[model samples]
Target: MPRKRPGRVRTKNTNRREALKLSTMAPEDYNVRPGEVKSIACPNCRTWRRIMGETVLKIREHCISDKVADGEKHVTCPGSNQVVIIDIDVSHWQARQNRLLRDAMPQENRRAARQFYKPLPAPAAPVARIHAGVTLETARRAYLAHVEECVRCGTGQHCTRGGALAHRYVLVRKEELARRKAHKQSAPAARKALWDQRGGATVETANNQCRPRLDGAVSEYRGPQVPSKPLRVIA
Candidate 1:
């Protein structure tokens, strides 16, 4: 009626139908609102979109209540249909801003607050002590200096090399002495009979057989030597 202008013009009825179609579409089909969150469990994608209309309304309300700057954007929840208008205190917000500004600067340029940083103290020194008297040191040295020498070599080094030979000779001599003593203690008739059977070869062979066998069982199980009593000092 007012003068139809523009190409592909729609009649009044057609324009009304188009508007109705748009209105019938769900609010979610368009945009999201601040504070109002919507959750969808769709097979294709699971995501929430804010409704701009609702967001703008809630933001306006929050700005009035909190007296926040008009330039700040409102925050939105991404879960179910719920909205929350945040009204942060100006002073608290400023402190938070200051912290962020400080954090943005280089570490070397930042001021060190002693309240946040403390130096560790140095460790204490250790105690010392001294010992007196002749002690064990003096005693040990005197003992070594006056120790007995080897009888065979007449040297300070004890004779360990000729030990086996000396042991065998002592054993043989002891056995001979025992046999002679037994013969002397025997009755007159028994002694005469033993003397009648004695031979040089038999006596020598018997003495050799009586000596300990180096490879025998008794030698293998020999116990450690028992130490003799310490010699008394003449002084």
Candidate 2:
């Protein structure tokens, strides 16, 4: 209950009212204002108890449970009559608490509470399609399967869903054909370039081998061969 104010020295615990020792607590521990019923959860017992005074707040003395006359030894709670001093400004603490509560709310729920918009049901999809990297054969099979199952599709026509599937299949087929054709046309040139590179490498290697050991350069990736004769050790 003791607070920092100019000129008035903080009274010692011995001099405090009700003979209860002073215990400093954070403003968040209890709810209080100029004209509201102040209450706090007892720290030791974890039970909600009304704060005891208007000018100075203190934790009320409380027993654990049954009274002495009940013949049950419930015992008194250790938190009895403990003085609580709220040092922080109540108004400032209240403002910060309000801001925190607002921030904690969900983004959707933070809007006006009076809003009564009904949530729209999610739109369902028809048969899911492989939008990317779909092979031509898979597309063709899917189109054929859809057409077979759909009664609206006939020998020379298709229903809307069947028609859409067929169109996708056609596009995939065209792309696959174009890719294969390009690969076929480029195969000869690719092979020729590969052959030319290999031929040049072969000729250069042959020339290097034919030039003999004039420069003492060892073959790549192969160390020099061991000498056939072991020398006699001179003692």
Best model per TM-score: 2
Model 1 agreement with the true structure over 1-235: per-residue lDDT tens digits: 3542222211211111111121333433322222224222211123333211222111111111222355555432222222223233435544654677798999888876654656788675321111123234443343333343336534544344334333334555566678788877887778667766887467868778866666634443453453346868898
Off by over 4 Å in 1: 1-152, 156-158, 187-235
Candidate 1: pairs in clash: 31-50, 31-51, 32-50, 32-51, 32-52, 33-50, 33-51, 33-55, 34-55, 35-83
Winning candidate number (lDDT)? 2
RMSD of each: 29.7, 13.3
Runs with alpha carbons beyond 4 Å of true place in candidate 2: 1-129, 200-235
Query: What are the lDDT scores of the predictions, listed in order?
Result: 0.38, 0.69
- How many pairs of residues in model 2 come into backbone collision? 1
Please state the error at residue 76 of candidate 2 in Å: 24
